[model samples]
Target: MQKPEIQQLLDKSFSDFTTFIGSLSDHRFIVSPEGKWSAGQQLDHLIRSAKPVNKALSMPRFFLRWFGKPAKASRSFEEIRDVYRDRLQHGAVSTRPYIPPVTEIGQRETLLKQFDQQKSKMIGLVGNWDEPELDRYQLPHPLLGKLTTREVLYFTIYHNYHHLHTLQLREKPEQPWPTQLERVIF
Candidate 1:
């Protein structure tokens, strides 16, 4: 797709994702039921993913050599699933599934706010860049392959949804929050 159109799509997706992330407020239930990291930790992981994303966006470009060819990378749910298993084996929770912690009661709101801010920066990064700029050079994705910057952004977009799906499964967030909440929370 053209750069402008892709940017527009990126903006819309970013808006939706921000809204979704903002809506998530089941901090009380994330880890209690599963003994995993709480919704806070899950969001931590999402914010963590952005660390690399920010580094990538700041890089000169990964597609410099790839004026042709696919110049991109793709990921599948199964691959991320395997990563989750590996993380479990190492004793650190993968944060693959989004479960809020029942323990750390103090950091939930701050953590979520951090995610919101970082997410906005990420959207800004994508908004200024486009598909064609992705054809500058190739970089190695942790699992996916050496690909252009654009492909990395593609992974970023899909990766957010992937975790969101995982969180949805973990949270089972069908019911609405209480009426007099402090956060108008998810």
Candidate 2:
């Protein structure tokens, strides 16, 4: 069974994502600031990220244990999140297959539905696994090496928050002085 804490975290994360998407206007969903991905692409990326994880979660425990090696040690969510953040800060980019398509008009509803569906499947798959399974099974992260199944779930949680922050930054009005004006004044 999913530990109560993990379930709660999943619940909150899903709820937060749904609320965030619901609040966005269609134009805002597809509007990226400069070179960044739009909010819709970020949501699409989250959907893509969840698929392999859900598939991995569905594999038999025997299969996972047989193919995967033991994790070094179980790390807290914060540790895993910090390592992931550092990698991004240092220029780790999403693999080609994981990058979402350009956010076109009218795509928000479709993308949001996909995100919700994937998240629900993820929650269901993980919920079926007990604590022992969560800790015993390991998977290779693209950047973080081997991680217990629990840590993967933690990544899913924080990954949403990371993109949410990005989306929020894009949405913020440009209140700072214009670059040209600043240069002239200085």
TM-score of each: 0.60, 0.87
User: Global CA lDDT of candidate 1, please?
Assistant: 0.55
lDDT for 111 in candidate 2 is 79
- Model 1 regions more than 4 Å off: 4-32, 62-103, 173-186
Candidate 1 local lDDT, 80-131, one digit each (tens): 4455446546775334333333436466667667766766676677666755
Worst lDDT run of 10 residues, candidate 2, spans 175-184
Q: Any idea what lDDT model 2 has?
A: 0.78
Largest lDDT belongs to which candidate?
A: 2
Candidate 1 positional error at 31, Å: 2.2
For residues 36-151, what per-residue lDDT tens digits would candidate 2 score against the true structure?
78778888888888888898999988878765766466778899899999998899989887898898867777877888788778878877998877888898777777789988
User: What does candidate 2 score on TM?
Assistant: 0.87
How many clashes does each candidate structure show, in the order listed?
15, 1
